[model samples]
Target: MEVAFSGINIYSKKPEAVFEFYKKLGFRVLEEVAPDDKWYGSTLALQDGDNAPIIWIWRQSDEDNSVVCNHFVFSTNGKMDEVYESIVAAGIACKPPFTAVWGGRELILHDPEGNELLFL
Candidate 1:
């Protein structure tokens, strides 16, 4: 068997707001599809860089069915500082970048819907 990570599904109560937050983080919207009778919710697929994993933001169809996790880590490609600055300029609150116990640098912030996003 073979497998590869392609994307993540983020269910949001206010998906439009979530999408704007991601856009500020440099995610370019590749496509958007609205929910139909056969689908659950509307969705927007986004990517930050060439070959980067796509992020799918979905409007919640069932309030109780939304999913949450500890966090999601995004690679900064050696531009952690620049990313941090951009986040701050966008008025997004974030913890200052710091070295992890594993010796990698990271900055942490939360999305509009309160999902933790870590940049490394």
Candidate 2:
């Protein structure tokens, strides 16, 4: 059950501003989704790194305002289900695992303070 820190998802009322700021700081756009898409956002990776994306800037959606959870995500090394089950068995509350718009299996857990942690 290997895991690696993936990235942070930032909800922004001004996604373009956030994008521009990161761009000026040497982050390259890895992918972008239009507003009409299921997930309107951009994935950004550092210019000099071969690692996976480190930042996700998501446009705030009016219809699903509750969907945006400022979360730190982690890759489960293809063991998302196993890890999810383990967490649940330990009596932690978690949302059912689901497939994310980016096509990765994901599970979200809430901390005591109600902050979310996403596992993919």
Candidate 3:
């Protein structure tokens, strides 16, 4: 079978905050759902025209059935340092960048919902 990776679904008690986090990281909102509706969420991408991965933020609620992965790694394309600086400047608590034993530079941080996000 031929397949292509496209996106990830993130669940959070405060989806808006998660969306805002991505926005601060340079992801633009492609579509958004009303908070008062059944679900609150936003589809985001680095650039509208690029084939880059998409991020789907969905609100966590008792009525919803979802499986969540609390950790995710994203490629910064050698911009890990810049991203680390921006995240810190935004007042987000994150560990300083470090070189991995495997020889990759990485930065670790948690989103509003406490999901670990590692940038490499």
lDDT of all predictions: 0.74, 0.68, 0.81
Model 2 residue 17 lDDT? 64
- Model 1 lDDT per residue over 41-103, tens place: 333344555556777776676636656864887788999999889888987778789999999
Model 2 over residues 1-111: C-alpha lDDT tens digits? 988868777766557766665555356788877755555698888634665657887776656556444555566789987877777665565678998899878887654
Estimate the overall C-alpha local distance difference test score of candidate 1.
Answer: 0.74
Native-referenced Cα lDDT, model 2: 0.68
Q: Which of 2 and 3 is ahead in lDDT?
A: 3
Off by over 4 Å in 2: 35-39, 47-50, 63-120
Question: Candidate 2 at 62: error in angstroms?
Answer: 3.6
**Model 2: worst 10 consecutive residues (lDDT sum):** 108-117
* 63-115 per-residue lDDT for model 3 (tens digits): 76665657878788988788888888877778899999999888988777777
| Candidate 2 residue 60 C-alpha distance from true site, Å | 1.8
Residue 59: error of model 1 in Å? Answer: 1.3
